[model samples]
Target: MVANDYQYILENMQKELETQAEKVGELTKERDNAGKKIGALEAQLSETKVVLDELELIGDDATIYKLLGPVLVKQERELALATIKNRKSHMETELKRCSQTVNDVSKKIAKEQDNLRDLHMKSQHVKQALMGAPQQ
Candidate 1:
């Protein structure tokens, strides 16, 4: 009866270990995706800054063409600069949020990893005990 009880407990622990491992895998993927998003946002922000700088250097009277779905629509120089500035500002905000998400997810991943390791150790001990038990 003790052996049977140990067997049941070991089975439950195995299930829990599997569940924790799956969670860790999901969290790892989430962290990787957030990292990729941060990279993309940084590149976009850099491009926007370059465009804004170029616009600032040009004369106010100069004609600017805004690309709208492959069509170059005439736009006021000031308006174009303002639009680009807004885009840059928005990108900056998005980057900040994404960076924060990465940090938070990283911490969660670390915690989950530690939990998985501890569960694995406990499961190993249980397996050893189960194996050493006398068979019915």
Candidate 2:
């Protein structure tokens, strides 16, 4: 009877050991899953920081949007378009003023040309009259 009791105790201890080992294995798997979740979150955070840094750079310099903003970002596009429109409007006004100035100068030039023509005709007539009257 004593030998049988010893054998039963050893078998029960073996089953308990097996159960404990399975529990440890499950805990290890859960730890690895948690670690993976943390790693993914960290990577996403790094990407977000990079994007924010680029945005800060853009906001800092007014000149940056004209050169680098079109392909990379979309926030400052409306402001850039407004600036371009304002420049175009100014150029149109300047062109109109230049056109008016040119027109005025052309009219003045035409007036001068007409005056020269009249003077030339009068000079020719005076010379003809002088030559025909006192040929003796």
Question: Which candidate leads in lDDT?
Answer: 1
Give one digit per residue, the lDDT tens place, for model 2 in 33-133.
54555465455545545544554556434543444645654446446545555555555555455455545555654565565556556555644554455
Report the number of clashing residue pairs per model. Answer: 0, 0
Q: Which ten-residue region of model 1 has the weakest summed lDDT? A: 1-10
Report every candidate's CA lDDT.
0.92, 0.53
lDDT of 1 by residue, 1-136 (tens): 4777887998899899999999999998998998999999999999999999999999988989989998999999988988999999999999999899989998998999999999999999878877887777
Model 2 segments more than 4 A misplaced: 1-75
The alpha-carbon deviation from the true structure for residue 128 of candidate 1, after best TM-score superposition, in angstroms, is: 1.8
Query: How far off is model 1, as Cα RMSD?
Result: 1.5
Worst ten in a row by lDDT for model 2: 59-68
TM-score per model over all chains = 0.92, 0.43
The deviation in Å at residue 9 for candidate 1 is: 2.6
Give the Å shift of residue 131 in candidate 1: 2.3
